[model samples]
Target: MDPRYFFFILFTLPTLLFGQINENGIKGYFSFDICEAVDTTDVIFSDYGGGVSGNIIRQAGAMNCVMDCSIRGNSFSMNGLDEQIVFFSGFQSVFNTSDFSIGFYFRPDPGVTKMNLFTKAEMCADSASFTIDYNPSSNQIEATLAQNSSIRTKVTGKLDPDRCWQHVTFVRDDRNSILYINGEQADLATASTRINAKNSSVLVLGSNLCIDRFRGLIDEIAIYDRAINANDVDDLFFHPEEIINRDTTIFLGGSVQIALSKNCADSYQWSPNAEINDATVAEPLISPTATATYQVDMISSDCTAKDEIMITVLDPDDLDCTEVFFPKAFTPNSDNLNDFFRINNPYTIDELISFEILDRWGSRVFFTDNPFEGWDGNFDGQVVNPGVLLYRVRFVCKGVEQTQVGSLTLIR
Candidate 1:
C-alpha cells in the first residue's frame, strides 16, 4: 500500500470501529441507571466501549431492583421465583474469546447462598461458556467457561454483599484468567476456556445459566474484546459523579420532607422515588418502604448541586410521634417576647390547615394558616378583652390528621 494509504487505514479503522474499542476498550455496557430507560417495555443498554446498542430481555421474574446509592446506580435483585436478565444475540455480540473480559458491580443480600451475576451460554449446554458469580459457602467470586460440568476459577475476596458494594472484573487470555474486586486482584487461575459467540449463546445477567437464579443487587455491567488493566479498573471505580450525603429516619410506610438548599437554587428534583406528592419544590416529600438513599438535584442559574439522603424506614409500631408544645397564655402588648403564642414542632406538621382563636361565644376572632404566626390579641382591628380564649389547631402528622383544642389567656 502507498504511504498515504497506510496512514489512512490506521486512522479510518478506529473511527469506523468507534463502538468496538476506544481509549477505554469498552465494547458493551449496561449501567442500569434506570434513568436511561424509555420505559419498562422498551429495555435498553448503551455500548460505551463499542458504541453498539443492545436490548435487555426480562426473561423470568419481575424487573424490580433497589437503587444502590453507594455507587450512584442500581443493583438488581433476582429474588422472584425466576427473575433473570438476558441479551439475545439478536441484540449484538457483547463478548469475544481472545483477550476478552467481563465485569459488573454487585452487593449480595443477607443470607445469600450461591448467586451468579453474569452468564452467556448456548441453550442446553452443560455449562455456560462465560459466567461470574459469588459463592457464600466460600465467600468468594468465581468465573467459569468451556464445557458443561466444568470447574469454576475462584477468586477469594470475602465481601459482605449485605453491607457494601463490590466491583468485580475478569480478564482472560490463552491461559490465566484474572479476577478483580474494586480494582484489586482477588484471585487468578488458568481459565478452562474463553467464551465463543454462537447463535444459541445468549447473555444472562443476575442469574446462573438460567437456573439457581441470583438474589442480589447487580449493576454497571460491561464487556470488552481486550483485557482491562488495573489502573483502568481503578479509574472505572472512581469515576466522577454527583455526590449527595444524608441520613434520615422515618416510620415504616411513613414519609420524609427533605429541605433543599434554599440559597438560590432555582430547580429541584428527587429520584428513586415512590409515593412522591411533589417534586418541583425546595422541600419535596418522599415515602420509601425500604432503606435506600433519596437523591435531590438542585440547579441554580450557574451550577447544580446533588445531595443524597439515606432514609431508614422502620415499622409503624416503632415510631413515637410526640412533638407537642404551646404556651398557656400570652400578652400582645408590644412586648415582643410574650406577644405571640407560636405553635411547637412547626416542621413536624405536614400541613397546617388552620390555627384559629375563638371568642367566648365561639366566634373566630384571629386566624392563620402559618403555624409560626401567633395571636396578637386583635379581633378585627380592636384589642380583645383580657380573658380566656379558645384555640383550635388542625394539622397532619405522619399521615394522620389531628386536631388540638385548648384555651389561652389574653391580657392587655
Candidate 2:
C-alpha cells in the first residue's frame, strides 16, 4: 500500500472512504479469501483478528466454497439446510458495549424467508442478544438489540434483494441506533440501553443457533468496537479513492465550488439542489443561505460511490442601534391601556443589569434587576401623588451594554 493511502485513510473524514476498511476501532475482520486457510475441519480464520474464526458445521446439504474477488472478494456460501459458521470464542466483550458496528455484504438466495443473517445470543435462557434477519412475510429486514428476550431497539427497513450483492450495517452509537443499507441511512432510533452479552453464547453467521438458517453468499464481514460512522459505511459499500476535497467552511453570503478529481466517475448526482447552480455536474457552484450537508453519488459501470461535504456558515452577532423604550408616563387608575410604568421593546434587550426608580428626594422607591418587572405608581403601600419619577436602566443588547436615564410622570 502506498504511504499516501495511509494519510488518506487516517485523517480524511467523509461519508465514505474507498478501497480499504477502516481500522480505527476494528475488532474483527473476516474477508474469507483464499489466503485464509481452514486448519481444522471447516474453520476459517479471521484476517485481522484471531479467536473469531469461522467454524463451519454442516449438519446437512452439499458444501459450496469458492473465492470471487469481484463482489467483496471471497464469500461464505450457505446451502440453507442446517449449515452455519459459528465463532465460539472472543466476542463476549466486543458486543457488550454501548457503541459498536457490524457490517457485511451478502447476496441471499431467492425466496429465502425468515433467514437469520447474523446472531449472538444464548439459547439456554433469555439474555442480552443481537440479531439481524430477513422476513419474507413482511418483506423487510429487521435488526434488533434486546435483553432477556425483550427488545431494546428494533429497526426494520425494506430490503428487496434480487440475488445481487448488498451491504447492510447496524450501529449503536450511545443512545442512537442506526441501520444503513447500501450507504444510505435506512432507519434510526434513540434508546440508551445496555446489551449485556456476558454469557456462554457465541456469534453465528448464516443461522440463529442452527435455526432459521440463511442461504446466501456472505463476505467482507467486519466488527468495530466503536460506532462506525456513515462515512465508513459508505467506504465499505463502494470502495473509492480520494476523489474530492475535504469538508469546507464559508461565511454567510459567500459562495463555494465543490469539485471532484478528474475522471473519477462517469456520472454525478448531487443532492439538495436548492442553492447550487447544477446538481448533475461534478463541480457545482453553491451559495447556501444556511449551513447544510450535500451528498453526491458518483456512478460508474463498476460501482456507485457516495460522499458528502458539510458547509458550515458562520453569521456573526453585532449590536444594533435599536434602543429599549421606558414608558414616558402611565396612570395607576386601573385602565388596562398604559396602566403600568414599564419598558417597551424589551425584545431588543438580552439582559437587564440594573433597573431603579426613585422619587424627587433621590430615595429608591422601586428597584428590580428583572427586565420584565416595572413599578405600578405605588410607594409605601399607597399610590404616590401624581408627580414625575426618575428611572435608571442599565441593560445589555446583543451582548453590548448601555444605560438610559429618563423621567416618568405618574397619573392618578
Each model's C-alpha lDDT? 0.60, 0.68
TM-scores for all candidates: the values are: 0.45, 0.50
Worst 10 residues of 2 by lDDT: 1-10
Question: Model 1 shows how many backbone clashes?
Answer: 13
Deviation from truth (RMSD, Å), model 2: 16.1
lDDT tens digits by residue: candidate 1, 1-412 = 1111000001112333223323455556655544333454333333333434333335322334455332545545555235566654323343544677776776565454677677776653555367676777776777765544553343456553222456788887555678787667877777556444333566666654545567656666766767777766665564222332258666576877666322325567778656667766667778887788777665554335566778876664444444546788888889567888777546456678889989899999988889678777887798899999889888877788788899998877
lDDT for model 1, please.
Answer: 0.60
Best by TM-score: 2
| Candidate 2 per-residue lDDT over residues 73-117, each given as its tens digit | 456677777677676555656777558898987766666358898
Off by over 4 Å in 2: 1-19, 35-46, 50-54, 59-63, 68-70, 124-126, 149-151, 160-163, 195-197, 239-412
